[model samples]
Target chain A: MVSVAFKKNLKEKYGIEFNNEDLLERAFTHSSYANEHHGKHNYEKLEFLGDAVLELAISDYLYRNYPKLNEGQLTRMRSNIVRTEGFSEFAKEVGFQNEIYLGNGEEKSGARNRKTLLEDVFEAFNGALFLDQGMSAVQRFLKQTVYPLIDEGDFDASRDYKTELQEKLQINGAIDIKYEVIAEDESVPTFTVQLLVNNQKVATGTGRNKKAAEQQAAAKALKK
Target chain B: MVSVAFKKNLKEKYGIEFNNEDLLERAFTHSSYANEHHGKHNYEKLEFLGDAVLELAISDYLYRNYPKLNEGQLTRMRSNIVRTEGFSEFAKEVGFQNEIYLGNGEEKSGARNRKTLLEDVFEAFNGALFLDQGMSAVQRFLKQTVYPLIDEGDFDASRDYKTELQEKLQINGAIDIKYEVIAEDESVPTFTVQLLVNNQKVATGTGRNKKAAEQQAAAKALKK
Candidate 1:
């Protein structure tokens, strides 16, 4: 049986209440508990659903808010926001640690603090929310929990060299740039990219990999 | 310069008009063309961005539509919908072959029907749409093009043993099932799963891999 106090606390924290107690229970029930019980309940499937839901919510939010942001920027931002650390923090903020049901071994080990566990729990919660309240409610929950993080722009900007190169090329009237992995070795594989102007190869670069080579090639071509 | 007749034809067929003619042109211009042009224009980066956008869009639509679908189901469905064959079909339906601007060599080699080219062009188109009209337009276009195929259940049903096992377990009130990859070898790895009831291993199975073994174990447990 779910504690009324726990439900009430969750509602106060997330600004939502669960209509289906089973869904909430499923969210908190760790795989270890299901293992010990011989698999009567677990959060694995829910975790999977929650992952997709979280990605969609974050992607949708990013897409709408940053119209000028390219796809690469949006992808990196989504990855940063949905990473284990971010989800764990979100789980703790929403009071999942206190409310979760864990097996004896897991409880003793402080599995609640594990990044993977917390992230899974966070996803499971989203799955539960979707089951209990519906997609709209889950979207609302996601917007509340994740939208603020996106607005903060805490994602790493250095990770988007590809987007940067594309934008730079577009601005320079060199609209065509290609990255191809022509060779791979044990070390850094060589990537070859040829920059074109009116269907002519103006610049070619070789690097440790396709991305690096492309960036170097683009940078070189830009100078011309 | 974009052909006026082609632009009108695209609008009539796709129900979308190009806001930025350059974006559309860029979408159609392949890396080979850009490489031949000396890197003045290319669709490779756009293809990359479009791939992500397409994935997110399809994932979002599936999440919203399938309330009862667990994460695995949604993932399998998404994969089925976005696989090479599906993309090629979508490309054909959209008349992409007619619109895409290919290099002379690629054109002669029938790159238009090539799965790789089709997938890339589809992704590039997605990138172009996202750039031209933002997320809403991309989302709408994806929903119209992809969602219906999913709704019609245009995927192999046999690929979802995990889901079937879960449903059976749920129905039978045998909630405890656990899968573990016990051993791996050069040829076929062995997996072990125990189906428990009140902390007892009621049934156990072995298979080529953990997932297959778990499913078999679940199947055996369900029979009891």
Candidate 2:
């Protein structure tokens, strides 16, 4: 049974309570718990739904707000915000660690405090929120938590390779560096990125997709 | 400009029409074309948005319909539906190839009919629909095309390992196989799968995550 304290906390924090409390319960149910119980279902499906919901919210937010940022920038931003560390932090902030349902063995392993479980609860809650109310509710929940993080520029830590590389190279004095897509292979559709410093190519990196290629190139350049 | 016949075709097919013809036009506008035009913008942003919109729609649909399928299965199903080949096929069916705007140089190079361009158009169009209408409109648009494809079970091709392996083994007559997780190393968080045939361990495979481990093990077993 979900606690009155948890429900009260939700009302205080997210400013909405669920009409179907069972959905809320299921959102916190770990797979191990469901496997042990005869009829209980886990949060895996909800996590799947939540993952998609979170993706939509973050993508939409990035799309509308950061008009000047390219797709790669937006993608990197979303990744920073929704990654396991970020999600786990959000879960902890919202008191999800205590609310998570676990099996006897899992609980003995201190599953409630596990980062993966916490991260998952954050997503499952998103799925539950989307189901309970709609897209608008999910948006509202994100606005309160995620939007603030964006405002603080907390998610900017990753994919700042250019800055890091520049800073590193600046110790040796002014440096000129550029990244160019050296190849775009059609079969796998990967982009091979080459980093050039002082008009000479120094490092090369390849990503199967667009976003990672530039970062990978920069990261390799920094290492050199 | 988006053609009147194209608009009529969309109306006949999707039963929906866009109020913002500009968005529709932008969806077909390629980067090379925009670079030459001096004033026109490309469809990259729209494609990014569309990718998210498409992800959300597909994920929600899978979550609702595939009640018994786990997260990995849902992920594979989504990947098959939205991958380059699938998106290109969808774009061709909707006549997006002919509609694509390209620079003189690009057109001469046959960029307009390229599979990557076709795939981009499919995503950009989705983004346009979402921006012009909303989430509901995007869902409606996908329901007309992608929903039917899912219903047809066309995505069953990717994870048919059981069928394939069984077929291969049946020729040899009566095979007993058991897959066990011998080790789960957290540094990579990989599941090491050991495949036992007739109670004798035949092969082992490792994957960075859960979904691919069993399949990798199966594939290795078959190779043996």
Candidate 3:
């Protein structure tokens, strides 16, 4: 049985009242708890949906706010903002640990403090919010909570492999840099990329796809 | 240089004129073309973002429209709608083959007609839409175009793996069915799941995550 006081506390903390209290309850209910409660409640499905909703909300915020930023910069920023560490921290800040329902085993193991568990629960909560309300509500919640963490000014702060390779080659007086997919294996569907600096093969790398292989080759070139 | 007539035709077909011509140009410009055109234009970055955006849009639509549908069903529906065959057909219908910019080699090889290429370009176009008009516009376009195709009773017409598995088990007089993640491998970060019918293992499968493993198990159970 879910506590009415718990529901009230969550509403107060989030500053939003839920019409379907069961949605909120479902968000907080962990798989361990669901197992213990004989499959009465679980956050698994909600977490799946929430993960998608969270990605969209974050992507939308980034796209709208940063008009001048390139795809690579936006991707890195998005990754930083949405990673498990960030979600876990946000969950702790929002007092999700106290609200989460865990089985006796999970409680004894301190599962609420686990970063992956908390992150999954946070995603599940977002999913529940989207299901209960709509995209608009989820977007508003993301804008209010998560959007502020990303700094547009720090877009080019990190040295990506491609950038690093270009810089390294330029310093060494290499005029032109080129990446070519040299070979593709059909069995594993792996692509082999060759990095050329001034018509000379500088490095080679393989990956599951061309972009990944190119990144790897660039990383290798940077190292050399 | 991209042909002006080609661009105009695309504008008429897509029903949205581009705010940034560069975005549209980039959407049509393949990596092969970019390689030939001094790397000034390409669809790789757009394709990455588009993939995420497409997944989110489809997931959101499925969650909202199907209240009784589970995560696996939603995922399968998304995959079916976004797969190479689906995208290839959609791309052909939308005149993407005519609009795409390809290198001489790619053009000679009929890359525009290739299923993988069509899928990539379609996703790249999605990225272009997101960049040019913002998330709202992209969301609207996705809801209008892609959502209808999924919701038009054709997608729901097919029997799903879970449903088949359930029906089969019921017919076989197996009163109890359960999916359990029996093992977790830290090396590959994979989970091994087993489908149990009447307290006996009916099928076993492994995947990168527990949900995937469970789905695989269900799929195997259906095959059995």
Candidate 4:
């Protein structure tokens, strides 16, 4: 049973006052908990929904706020903010560890303290929060959590590998730097960009987009 | 210059009447097109936003319509529906090839007709549409295009690997099966699940999530 104090604490911490207490409860209910309790619906579905909502909110914020950053930079920044480590960190800050409802086995194994599971439930909580309160609620949650981090240049201070690599190679006199897109494979289907220096291919990297691949390739080249 | 005729046609064809005509213009403007035009924003930013919007819409639909399907199946189905092939197909149906603005070079080289470009423009259009008209309008576009395809079992029929792999190994009588998470590399940082049969590891596969990794592992094992 979810305590009223927990709900009140959530409201105080995140300003996320849920109208649907059941949805809020469902968000914290892990799959193992659901399975052990005879096929009850778990947070997986909510996680799916919340994952999308979280992405859109974050993407929208990045697009609106970061005018100078190209799509690739925006994407990488979003990835940095929303990826597993970042999410788990945010989830921990949101104080979900004590609130997550785990099955007996998972509880015995200390699954509530698990990093991956912690990240997952935040996404699920956002999803459940989205269902109960809608996108604005999720947006509000992000505004409080993700936006501040972005504003503080937390994800922005990462190395510009392509710039670094280009500068390094320029000492050998000016050479042609071309990044070409290799034919994409259908499995996960990301674009692979190969870095060609003076018409000789140095390294290749894959990403969901071209610039990201080029950056990775540049990083690989620098390493070499 | 975006013609009024194109806007009228979009209204008639896809039922997308834009409140912001500039956004409509921006949506069709490719990166190459923007580069040639001098400081004009391209569709990439919108594509980023729209990509997330399109995903959330498709994800929301899949979640609601297919309750029995787990998050893994829901994700695969969404991927199939919103992937490059599907986006290009839907974009072609909406007559974007004729309307898309390519740069002089791209126009001469037939980049407008390119499969990947076609896919990209639709995603950008959705992003622009999402910004102007919001999620409901985007959902309407998907309903006319993506939802129908989903209903027709277009993405439903796929090879069931786990079942096939199980049956194949069962011919030898009782076999031990285990899928283990070997090591998670934070670079791409997806769960890498390794399949084991009779305590011997067979194949490993990676995914953004566990179930997807397991599916890929199963698929690999089936092939073996």
Q: What's the count of clashing pairs in each model shown?
A: 27, 0, 0, 2
DockQ of each: 0.12, 0.50, 0.26, 0.56
User: Residue-wise lDDT of candidate 4 within B139-172, one digit each (tens)?
Assistant: 8988887787678555653654666788888898
Question: Where does candidate 4 stray beyond 4 Å?
Answer: A157-224, B157-224
TM-score of chain A of each: 0.66, 0.71, 0.65, 0.68
Supply the global lDDT for candidate 4: 0.80
Give per-residue CA lDDT, model 1, range B91-194, as digits (tens): 65666767777778988999878877877888888878887886678877766666665665555344444567677668867676555544545233344666
* Best-to-worst ranking by DockQ: 4, 2, 3, 1
Off by over 4 Å in 3: A1-22, A32-41, A61-83, A131-149, A152-224, B1-22, B32-41, B131-224
Highest-scoring model, TM-score:
2
Each candidate's chain B TM-score? 0.66, 0.71, 0.65, 0.69
Off by over 4 Å in 2: A157-224, B157-224
Best by DockQ: 4
- Model 4: residue A44 alpha-carbon error in angstroms: 0.8
Q: After superposition, how far is residue B4 of candidate 2 from its true place, in Å?
A: 1.3
lDDT of 3 at B202: 90
lDDT of 2 by residue, B21-62 (tens): 899999999998999998898999899889888988998998
The deviation in Å at residue B72 for candidate 1 is: 5.7
| TM-score (C-alpha, index-matched) for candidate 4 | 0.71
